[model samples]
Target: MATSGGASCSSSVLPCAFSRHYLAVCAQDGRLRVWNTDTQSLHREFVPSAHLSATCTCIAWGPCRASKEGPQRKKRKSEAGPAPDQQPDLLALGTAAGTVLIYSTVKGDLHCILDGGHNGGVNSVQWHPEQSLLYSGSDDTHIVEWDLQTGKTRCKWKADRSAVTSLCVSPDGKLLLSAGMTIKMWDLETKEVYRKFTGHSTTVTTLCFATSRPPDSDGLYFLSGAVHDRLLSVWQVRSDGKDKNSVVSFTLTDEPQYIDLQTADSKDKAVRLAVVCKDGQLHLFEHFLNGPCKKPLSPVCSVQVSSVGAGEGATPAPVTLLAAALCPDRQSLMLAYGNYLQPIVEKTQINTSERHVCLVRDVHTTLSLSVNAAVSKVKTPIVNEQKGKVLIPGVPGHQAPIRASSGESDKRKKGAGPTEMSIEERLEQVELSTLGRKGEDKGASASLQTDSFAVLLVQGLESKDSKILNKIFQTKKEALIRNTVARLPPPAVLPLVEELSRRLQGHPFSAILTVQWLKAVLTQHTSYLSSLPDLVSQLGVLYHMIESRVKLYQRLTRLHGKLYLLMTQVASSNSSHKVSDLDREAKLVYEEESSDDEEASGDEGRPEDDSDSWEEEEDNEEEMDVTENKENHTEDEEDANKDAEESKANGDSDMDPENESEEE
Candidate 1:
């Protein structure tokens, strides 16, 4: 059979049928369209008259001559080989107006119209392969068998209380299966229900017969798919007087609209089912009809046929798949929906010979390489022996032997070396090296020296090395000691602090650094440190040292301030005293000058007047010197006070009692 590639038709295509040469499609607008599969083009369109303005619900093609029976069939041959006087293959179209329209495929003309077969819309129709009969199920809960030759209903029966949604005939045309609210099997000759299957909780919408038998038995099987429950069931009719049934289910991401089965290959008998869902996705499943397993249907994959374009956070629009047809070649599928028909082709498989050849070649190459490597290894000793005979021109013949014996002796000596050192010895060596001394020179390294503070701290804590511990405290770098102590675990930090304190006996600088280190560790690691009671108890000493230092610094600061105030007051008092003395001297000098002026006027050329002037000048010079010295001293005192104020502004003092108390 030929398949179309990239061919699609405008949608609202309800039901579709495929023959060898032509594809017939019924649309919602009461129109029937035919397509030529070879040319991938529309062949004809048949639109019903305006008086019959009802949607076409389903369609099917008449059986070819090969499948025909009775005396009238002798006049017809194959579907593509009708005699000159024979009629063309017929097309049956079921409409929502409860009428069945028969058209001529070749002439593209309506030949017969079978009306009043269904009271409500006909939902499904199927033509008998070996008889001039057509069966239809409708929403009015009726199944009608129509005689195409006479254009009349042969019989009518009620299949269910609800709408008869789908119908299928057995391979031998003896049994008919109808699905509605339940599935029922009817004996065509007797025209009576033979059996009823009623497991579905909702309406059964689709049915199809399987062409294969079950495992370890020869039996006919059919599948039923239902709504609301999203269940597909398999029922068997055996020839050995036994029947079997099974149900398979899956998570319904969306409501199932239609299901179609296709055999993978006619020779292999492997079947796969395709389901079109309302969520714009077509899901595929593999059905193992002849397998020994209980469940026969398994999910394979799904493909998205449409996409919601309303952006995120918006509900996706529902898609209704009206019809689907799988090509007999099992390579292409046709899906019908709103205004579109899409064809999907199956993926091809790799060639078995080419794959096997490449695999074998890779294995052969790898094996050959491995064999060559092993052979080379097996011959390596002989090759080395041959090379050993050749010697350099500068070397003596006996020298090689001597060197070989020496190498052997060295290996033996190394293998028989002394036992390994203990953990304490190794730690001691590391500590001594960190303290800027050779490990062997412990006596000469009496003075505390810290080269690597971190190594010294870790080794000292681990080995309890008192010498290294003392050096860590003696190190002038406060930051180095603080960082090393902080790196230690909370449990070890307190003991290390106690040890450093013990070693810091009379060294105030070391003791202060140790206390600062302890405070930093406690403050930064309080969460981990608080869990250790010993560490928390040891914190008392650190707090005490900090408080004492704070109090001492505060007292020293207060004393300094008081001393400065006292010095300034004393300087001011002295200045005032000197000013008073100067005032008195000025008054006395003024009176003396007036008296001298009068005496000089009275005894103008006396020798005593010259001596008195000289004496007065010397006294005035001495008084001026004393006043200059006092002013200089007062300026010095003011400069000292300014310096003290600047130091206080720069936070040079260890404690400010006001800020310290607030912090506490």
Candidate 2:
């Protein structure tokens, strides 16, 4: 999909797209456009916010279309789905006018304007796949979820008393995360403020979520780089509830600039990348969320993708990843600058004579299909008495329409009324609808529409490999139970205990019952709920082989309780998208099993959530750095060993003494 190797445009608002071969741009004369680098064509342009008055700051494509339908069919077949639209279309766009607009990229036409969307300039806009929703946050210190299909505001809030600079909807569309002075997380379905993470020391400029399986994750596990002193971080989000060590962080190279992620099954396969750079050159880095940290953060090919190329250009200030479009074959990446204003505007004011504009306009003089000519034939001029000139061009007889500003709602914003209850007490309200149903479910499908559970069997691997995996999982199921019991979130542990109590009501499989109790303690507070469904299935399979239905049922019941905790955690947290992935993975396993069983009689699998703004995202990145390396190292070389000491003398949990001494 590579063109002869260069872009010719002189625009500043370049946004990177995921899964689309073309990238989009917000132009100086107030135009929104897209270019297909592979064909070197300035494909489409639209002016939804009007004139040269505002700079569009953000642009986002709808979630990968096929990804939204990933449940039943994918597990049943080994096939790729449909191709993306021929004309290409972006899902949402936000401008300096404080307007959030939705339109199809193919038509180059405006679909809807989010009326009374945000108070101040709109900074970011995003769409969730699988569901019909959209969200936007602005300089007004508010984030709102809008139903694009309805042109209605599902929910809106005035976040801290400051501007809301960045916005993100988790992969599952359950959490709406907005970062400003402090991070504020909302439960999308019921509109609840589950957490208010207070950690970033300054303004947060960029936010990205990591996937549990890598390569495919969104910004659910948000790592926000603050503009304050430039710190980058990761968070452990779940529906199980909020807890400590929630945020772990690390300082970055230059203001912890724009960051993105990608997942790789192996080196040859195209690795997914999401990047935001503070460098003029577009810096693309691989996001390896699942791999051990010692693995380097590789860059696929960082290049001078966008050049100043003469005219009003001053070496475009640090390029940021504003929007991304991935092509249909899923093999190409499209980068664009969707939301970048203040910097470009500052540079614009420098051209006192508009010499840069004249030069830029001259460069495009060859394309004679003029927008002004098109407007002249169909419209009238809107007069602005103060400027003594025309403001909006419209039909000859039609006047510039008086568009009324959204007056303050007497209803007051939801969740803003005086509250006599404590934060903890308000949390008990479980509509889990705190964030509002505005962000589309990151990706949706029939599999995730239910509440049952399923498992994923490794594909394309040898039987020996499969056996090894089964064995490792079998061992970990029991071992992990003992290891992490104390760390389980209380909400999860209590539900699991209740579930086990119900299963034992049958008065059978007492030995399995005891294992159930231990299981609850082990998985108490970890982000490892992604592993529970398989653990239970494996346990049940063992019992089935041994001819013990009672024990199998008892074991399954106990494991179910633990998973219920994870589901509930997702039901309420900023990381609900991860829960959605877990749920989708289960469907794959079950669908595979069902195919074989249906020939005889029967078979099946289940689904993923997140919570946040409670803990600063930067904090989690710190703990994550060490947690990965500590899993493998030289332990007893300094007599600081634990797990491997009996066989090789190495501690699996903490750093070695030599390293410890180095610290001293």
Candidate 1 global CA lDDT score: 0.58
Tens digits of lDDT, candidate 2, 472-496: 2233344344433342323233233
Tens-digit per-residue lDDT, 349-418, candidate 1: 2222231211011111111212234334444434665346532222111111111135534664676322
Model 2, poorest ten-residue lDDT window?
2-11
Report every candidate's CA lDDT: 0.58, 0.46
Q: Model 2, stretches more than 4 Å misplaced?
A: 1-19, 64-90, 212-220, 228-231, 238-260, 263-276, 282-664
Cα RMSD for candidate 2? 42.0
TM-score of each: 0.42, 0.40
Best by TM-score: 1
Best by lDDT: 1
- Give Cα distance to truth, residue 558, candidate 1, Å: 99
